[model samples]
Target chain A: MNEQSITLKKKPNLGRRIGDEIKRNFVLYLMAIPVIVYFVVFVYLPMYGLIIAFKDYRPFNRMGQGGIWGSPWADYYGFGNFVKFFQSPLFWSVIKNTIYISLLGTCFSFPAPIIFALMLNEIKNLKYKKIIQTITYLPHFISMVVICSMIIRFFQTEGILTKLITLLGGEKQNYMINEDAYRPIFVGSGIWQGVGWGSIIYISALSSIDQELYEAAVIDGAGKWKQLVHITIPGILSTIVILLIMNIGSILSVGYEKTILLQNDKTASVARVISSYTYDLSFGEGNSDFAYSSAIGIFQSVVNIIFLTIANTISKKVTDSGLF
Target chain B: MVYKPSIGEKVFNLFNILFMALMIFICFYPFWYCVTCSLSKQADTASLMLLPNGFTLATYKDVLAREAIQKGYLVTIFVVVVGTIINLIMTTIAAFLLTRKNFAIRGFLTWMMLFTMYFGGGMIPTYIVYTQILGLEGSILVLLIPGCISVYNMIVMRTNFNGIPTSLEESVKVDGGNDMHVLWHIIIPLSKAVISVMVLFYGVGHWNSWFNASLYLQGTEIQPLQLRLREILILGQTAAEGDAGDVSTMAENIKYATIIVATLPILLVYPVIQKYFVKGVMIGAVKG
Candidate 1:
């Protein structure tokens, strides 16, 4: 009887247990059905549409003129659009502009939050800290459209901000018209808008730092600065590294919408990244080149993926923290 | 908590206080200016800045009177409520399934969700699928269905589920309870904190999202509050040709008021659900 039971138990091991688990969690599986269907229909199915990137995709004769699958000369056009993109006079400039803006934005915006969080953590008066945090967080929820509009208004000629700058002995310049000022305006505004809200995560990480460590540092006659440097900084190092890695991964995406919104005739040259270019080509009077635009979008996404992977690998090697 | 500061520390504290105060003012000033501008007299408002010389609720009344804005508000509210409910249900079930030690395909299912984060068919393709393939364009289903299960949120919910002690599941199994019974009776009750976090995430996402609406409902009256506000604020400013009384001035107060209106619900709900958001983001950031 014991031998028979042992053989039966072995039969119901791992794989069989999984099967039974699936059966038991039938209700849960039912709940997941809609989501599964969603991705399969919207995401997986459309990946096939990427073939249009290779083809001379026409809206009217989608199926006969060259379906994504059976298009004539579509395969030959392989890398044709890519070659055109690379050979275009704007290509190198596009890459340069994207990297420059993203890096500048990240460099300014990322550290602002950490500094804000540290300063907030140092505050003894709870009410004042709360007020500061509340005010700071409010800007984040404002619609990007509204934010962009406000930026336009505040930087325009005779605006209050301009008046203030003039009073401070600076010439009342149309800062928005200058290409050199674009990076500063974008990065500065991003940091100002996001620092408080972004700092909330770091503040949480700070709170999680063991209270005993600070006490121990105090007993060792460590000053407030020393405690913050040795105890607090070390405590939140991993969160910092993880966030840094994630930020580095998307270094090419300069958020085209805001740039497009903020763009004018003068700033367009400096502001136009792959995203804005693709958008202009697809929708704007430039080309209305949908297939070309899609190809560019793919190219941008591929570059981002590569950057992210490299960043992740580097983080794993150096800091032992990665988003894998 | 009643720690005293040294003289040097006090000076530093004072500096910090001033800096924080300055930061707060810098942040709040734009909204304040916008409010002032909107309320000011139209032509007179062109050069006006800082505080409003003449405060009026005229712009607020005008915005509220617009049928488009009103409809947008209703649509946004409906989408948020329904979308969050769907998110909570789907995520809760998935989280419940993940907690089962005997669940064999758990890792596979988890990775399936995560795959979406790295790779997605870009917007155009996704739009084609929704419009041509799914035939759900201009429908309410478009808003709730396309982004129903965010992989990041799913992973967070699953991680929270994993933190629930394994004994909770085993004890229920010991009583011969089936999976559904245990999920409803035990897991649902226990996972309230994470559920609320997921709700806030979904709610805020739905409230803020206008891109999808702009894409899918091209000609329909399916404008959500954000979309309507966006059309006025973004599209208004960029292509300001039809009107001439300083488009910026016209938008000033109404823009701030609309922003306040759009964001106030979440702000009100936030404090009640603040602890969950704090805990969720903290844990998610660390684990992530």
Candidate 2:
């Protein structure tokens, strides 16, 4: 044990004494310089500016805001913006809409790719499979603005979808302008755009399963369904769990940029999310409400963090897979 | 022997086929409708029916003829090329450096990258930093600079680099190769899969990006294609439906055409590079 400990201690020294590792690896460091400077300039340095959330910030009065620390602290107000946001009537409704939309998206859209991957797995014809995959994946690359535009055109009263709805004996109501239709449209479109591309990950996971397991199952008189349930799912569980945890972590972020692009005043009641609301507050032609928006943003981030931590903890306890 | 299905299994199969058909139709119909509608006459477009009332390229012609859109196309192309190059350089180098285990400060460096993943300074401050501090407010650099290194891309590339067999490195060193030579000669060649992954991801991201340009450029001349197309879509819809009356009917047809021009190139190019995309995503997702 003493000799082993001495060898372990000497090991690090041997590696270090090899040279001025930086000098030897100077090219690597040189390669890394731009990336390092980039992160510092773009990510870290701006992080110092998060302090503006605590300040009475105006773009023109930026220097006079006493540069964050010197500004009047939020301590005196005791989460005043937080309280104001909570007290606002839009808070609960927006929160409800967000949860409803995200949850609906999660329930419907999340498993869509998995189901897609499973189905694609069942398809033995490789050429047809490739063609289907290619066609379906196209939407994921389409710009949101264009996607939204296509959606708008397709749902118009005279549009094909609307005509089909009429043919199917449904009302020809213009759903795009309806507040109640927001969730369905958002979730529906999200699934359409995402499902095919999302399956790419799971398909890879499914592919990684040992071929012998399937062959053995087949030899054991097991069917495709049984093999899938017992072997395939279990093989992909850890990947699924990790992905699920990451999804849970970002539950608060409902891809709001797309949501914003899709939203109209009619849909805004049901569609406005924390991110969109913050966007409005920041860029809305009214008062420069930076503090309020930041406060809400901070609150949203806190909730996301809390949910992420709880999810990690619960996943670790239940399934032994988590981000941390 | 016939593969006879029991009633339950028959129902299951029916349900599966129905669901699959429904999903494919839902996924595909909107784009089909959009393309057909854009090609249709104004009367047909207004009717908005399944099939075109009459086919015409009038809208495409009108949209293509616009000076603003032509300029927007130029700007967008410029931004995408510059942005993707910057992203590749920054992310690939960072990935390379982080793969070296004995870098002495690897953990610290990694922690620095990871720290940015969870925390951000929010918009206003970042806006200030770029506009006020960097003086890139109205410049095209604003679009290119702020997002040079996506942490996600960096992590993916790092993992890819790490996976390259260490034996290759040893063999290179036996030939008396330096770090740069090894990286350029061996590591990069081996990393084509991941590098291509970054290229597609970063390229698509840059191509589709508009919010940064919207926020920063403020100049009509420098605005990207997506921004221009988005504005056209919004303006066209408003003019057609709303009482906002300064715009002409010609603008409506132009807007429809603008949508086609903005999207068609990417749609055309996607199928070409899509195989590489799938490969990249598969490789990244496995280790991701």
- Candidate with top DockQ is 2
The backbone clash count of each candidate, in order, is: 1, 1
User: Which numbered prediction scores highest in lDDT against the true structure?
Assistant: 2
Model 1 stretches with alpha carbons more than 4 Å out: A1-23, A60-67, A72-77, A169-178, A285-287, A312-324, B1-6, B41-52, B166-177, B241-275
TM-score, candidate number 2: 0.89
Error of 2 at B88 (Å): 1.3
Off by over 4 Å in 2: A1-19, A60-70, A75-78, B1-22, B43-53, B167-177, B235-240, B244-254
Tens-place lDDT digits, model 1, residues A31-71: 56765676677667877667666766555463455344554
Alpha-carbon shift of residue B262 in model 1 (angstroms): 4.1
Candidate 2 reaches a DockQ of 0.54
DockQ scores for all predicted structures: 0.46, 0.54
- Candidate 1: docking tier: acceptable
The per-prediction i-RMS, to one decimal, reads: 2.9, 2.4
User: What does candidate 2's lDDT look like per residue over A1-324, in tens digits?
Assistant: 999988777646645655667777777677767777888888877677676666665455645644444556564454766877889989998788778877897789888898888877766667867877888898999888888876776576655567767878978866677777678888998888999999998888898899999878877877667888999999888878887887887777777668767777677898898888888887766756766777788888888889889989999999988888
Candidate 2, overall lDDT? 0.77
Report the lDDT tens digits of candidate 1 across residue range B1-288.
Answer: 445667988888889989998999888877666666666654232353676667777777877787887899899989999988987876676666566665656676667667777787776655555655568888988888776777777778878877777687778879988777777777778888888788877887788787778767877988888778777766666555335445645545566566555655766775566556666777677676
